[model samples]
Target: MSTAFCFGIRFPMFICMSSFAIIPTSIVVERAIALWKRNKYEHYGCRLGFAISIICIVVSLIMSAWSMGKMNLSDLTVYCSATTNETADRITIICFTYCGIDVITLSGMAWLRTSNVAAMKGKYSDLRSSYQLRENASVIRVLLPLVVFDGLSHLVFSLGGGVFLLFRVHFSYVAYRTI
Candidate 1:
């Protein structure tokens, strides 16, 4: 029952965070392909950063699943309940690590996007005074917000995950004591 409730909370969060991670990845890939067609090798770093972010997102999801499994195991649950402080500390540490990785990846993507925007602005300045600059400006605007939102979401997730892990540790401890 406790396991079920733990999963109930994590499942929705996983879906939400995954969606946030995946959509920007798609945009990054699309823009990279477009820039590549234009012979802009400059955006390669941004592409690479987004690719890494995608990988980190996948790995984090896997870790979350594994942690859920550990929670479901009867022996581990019992142990966790008995050693609440220890369990909480360990869980908090793991969650903090995961969240830190997520934040770093998101920040990388954001920095890459910011650089891309700066480059585009410089490259398209003369073109900017023309109608063609519309597309260029639009891309800059789009990438800017995506990057910002992605980073912010990662930060929020990190904080939420840390808090949730702490709560789980306490809950496990209480359950163990009562049962």
Candidate 2:
């Protein structure tokens, strides 16, 4: 296929995929921040969340542009394949970055939940504070599994890619090779 055709297809695909991966994490982080700063977040949460989403989109666009620039389009053959070492490196970096962010956010949420529970023990009225704590706990309980799953999936994929790259094994060959 022509280089233009390949670029046209791949560039948008990259942007969409990157945005999909990043936007959720950004929203989850925003929620965690809201949990931490309830007062300010209550007033400005919508704008703040919008800003974070915009930042994520912009970052993904920049990354996609940089990655597309690094591609050796001149070498296109029968099909457009982003199997270069640079592509592999970029994927690994992106996956690991996602994993790292997930870990930090998860830890922060856990800490916030614990500290708030401890602080509210005797300092505040059990009725109101307990209800708030229960709400926070429920949010945490829902978020914890989703974040852990996302992080673990990214971690596993990145590690697998790293191992394959280290061993100089191509994924297509491994996955599609004849027995």
Candidate 3:
């Protein structure tokens, strides 16, 4: 049950954070693709991107609620933990899934950032166009690194939990710091 509590928190969090990364990164990706394809009628990408983001958000929320339901004890301590075979498997799954999403989303964001920043270095027709491009580029430059850093820390926490589960290691500080 304690093991359940540990994963109950982590899986939901991974789902939520991964969704956050995927949604915006996906929008930028879609826009980049539209520009690459020279498609003038690309407003549809906004709608499609929003639709996918909504679906991902809703699904993540529901899953989070479902996992919370598994935590039956009202007075359960967040610090409580356990190591067992089941937990090892759960940790492995969480780590792999989290890393997979991190790679896909962060890589897409990096690509989008590179393409837009590259375009910003080229000629823009007007002052307003240049200003907006530079602003967008700046935002991406600031945000993507933060996202990558946070995601990498999450990966470390998941791996730490996995090691604890499999080897009875007491690296619970990873969870404490991360959570």
lDDT of each: 0.53, 0.62, 0.57
TM-score of each: 0.47, 0.70, 0.53
Q: Looking at candidate 1, what is the lDDT of residue 106?
A: 64
* Top TM-score prediction, candidate number: 2
Candidate 1 vs candidate 3, lDDT winner: 3
Clashes of each: 0, 0, 0
Please write out the lDDT profile of model 2 over residues 47-148, one tens digit for every residue: 886799789989888877765676666655455644454465665465455556556655665676676566546454545445555666677678767766
State in Å the error of residue 69, model 2. 2.5
Model 1 clashing-pair count:
0
Q: Supply the global lDDT for candidate 2.
A: 0.62
Error of 3 at 60 (Å): 3.0
Residue 145, candidate 3: Cα error in Å is: 3.6
Q: Is candidate 2 or candidate 3 better by lDDT?
A: 2
How would the candidate models be sorted by lDDT, starting from the highest?
2, 3, 1
**Cα RMSDs, all models:** 7.2, 4.1, 6.3
lDDT of 1 by residue, 1-179 (tens): 36455456665575455445455655555544444343443436576667766775776576545444444433333222311333445445655664665565566555555655565555443432333234534675667676667657766776776786666635654563453
Scored by lDDT, model 3 comes in at 0.57
